[model samples]
Target: MPLHKIIHINETTTAYFWYITEDVTSLFRAVSLKDTSLFRLEGMKSEEHQRGFLAVRMLLQHLGYTDYDLSYDEAGKPHLSDGKHISISHSHEFSCICISNKLMGIDLEKLKEKTLKIAPRFMEVKHLENLTTSEQIEKATVIWGVKESIFKIKNEKGISFPEHIFEDEFDLKDGKCTAKLHFNNQIENFQIHFYNVEAYIFVCAFPNK
Candidate 1:
């Protein structure tokens, strides 16, 4: 299940998904990673983490990119050798990346009961009302991803999900929504697109133009 799907979000951005079905050794052998990436891979404490890291490289290769073309900033945001933007995320069994000419952030979250349980911590509790248990889990997962994607896009300190990011009213079936970030003395808006992929919810956020 390599390169599971490619989503053309717009003319300038695309999202790629990779289902990690290969062993760590096999994945490592398939991609040519830079020395820094190799060092980071070795330091990862879990095999699942290593596989997710390698799967990202495989995705880059699929897009005609290699580890050499990707770099991370001091804030841990990814960058391309070119001026294009990039965001990466991985959940339990899936890893994904989104590349764009515009600033963007993406997150992949596996559906879980824990996210629903902790919904009040990061989101408005009223939004969860009038929904079934399963819908509550899915909706909370999406809201979490929304904040995560926005945080990644800003990559600045002091951005708290509960205190700063707010998801406006939206229905699950809409598959898209809007959010606002009230932080750093400025308010910015975002357009969010989200959908279920396998057992995970994929969310992409782009700052309002």
Candidate 2:
């Protein structure tokens, strides 16, 4: 397989969709086969995450980065040795990355039935009270994406829904929403951009503050 072309959703965000047919070898050649192989092995945990790593690697290469070094800090947040702000997400065959001069976060999740089944775990009573059956599942999915993006941005653990992060009520028609994030004794506002693509809800969050 040839090196699949990179797809850019925007100037700062790019997504690479991988199938088993893609040229994993070429990717390894561009970077280090040893490093790519380690991520490939992680496919056992979740093929989705593995594919995401491949896409992320491709994006990094496009940005003129050949040597990619990743390490986890004491808080378990991923840090790049080069000191760039990076965020990644993968779901099923698709993976996405957001690279920016400032802090950023991105999330992509497969629209699964489980999202609906466990909606209560993440939503607050106020959110539930306003949700109608018609839009409950869709709203819940957006909120999930928001929360995941927050986790990626903060790089810290132990946050609850409704209490820590609050999303403003939004309509699916708008295709986007905003949220207020409360963390680390600071109230930071954020804007969430949502994209409905190929049965998946992709959300990207940036701090407005």
Candidate 3:
């Protein structure tokens, strides 16, 4: 699959997903990269990482953007030439980019038993009670993504998931939740949206307006 899915988050925000089935050579040939991107691609240690990076460019092209229009700041946040907010993520075989007029963040994580095992380090273990093994894995992955999505939005140093971010009680079936970030001596609320993509979990976060 190429452009696997697109989620219209709202009037001003949209998220795009690319399922990477193409080899690096094919993906590289399909997208035009600026010199810096090419240099970064050449420096990547693994073909999987290269494919994920190119897949992001392919997604940008799908929306009338190219590598030239994408840039990164010192904090490693992505920026568009047009000034729209953009967040990018990739894991295993999936790559994603979310663009919005407002500040936002996104994350993609494959469902794994390890996430559930380490849940207590990043989230409230009580939320996993009364769930089956599979449900535990799914819910844990969502909470991890919630913290990751919010972290990407903040992109500040010293924000620990366990110590600073908290997810309110929410059911897995609800497909949405709210979270708070207690960082830099201020508490900021966020709206979270999550989905199951094959065996992966996709999450998006936007500051509460």
Listed in order, each prediction's TM-score against the native is: 0.98, 0.74, 0.97
Residue-by-residue lDDT tens digits, candidate 3, 1-209: 66899899889999999999999999999999999999999999999999999999999999999999999999998999999999999999999999999999999999999999899899999999999999999999999999999999999999999999999999999999999999988999999999998899999999997
Candidate 1 lDDT, 1-103, residue by residue in tens: 6799899988999999999999999998899988999999999999999999999999999999999999999999999998899999998889999999999
lDDT of 3 at 48: 91
Model 2 per-residue lDDT at 102: 62
Clashes of 2: 0
Best by TM-score: 1
Instruction: Choose 1 or 2, whichever is better by lDDT.
Output: 1
Once model 3 is optimally superposed onto the true structure by TM-score, how far is the C-alpha of residue 100 displaced, in angstroms? 1.3
Error of 2 at 199 (Å): 1.1
TM-score of 3: 0.97
lDDT of each: 0.95, 0.66, 0.95
Task: For residues 1-209, write the lDDT of model 2, one tens digit per residue.
Answer: 32333444457555443332344444445554345446545554754454455656665566665434655567756566678766767666665566556677878777776887798777753565566664666667888999888777876666776579888877777877888878879887888788776677778888887
User: How do all the candidates rank in terms of TM-score, highest first?
Assistant: 1, 3, 2
Pitting candidate 1 against candidate 3, the one with the higher TM-score is 1
Candidate 2 lDDT trough over 10 residues, lowest sum: 15-24
Return the candidate ranking by lDDT, descending: 1, 3, 2
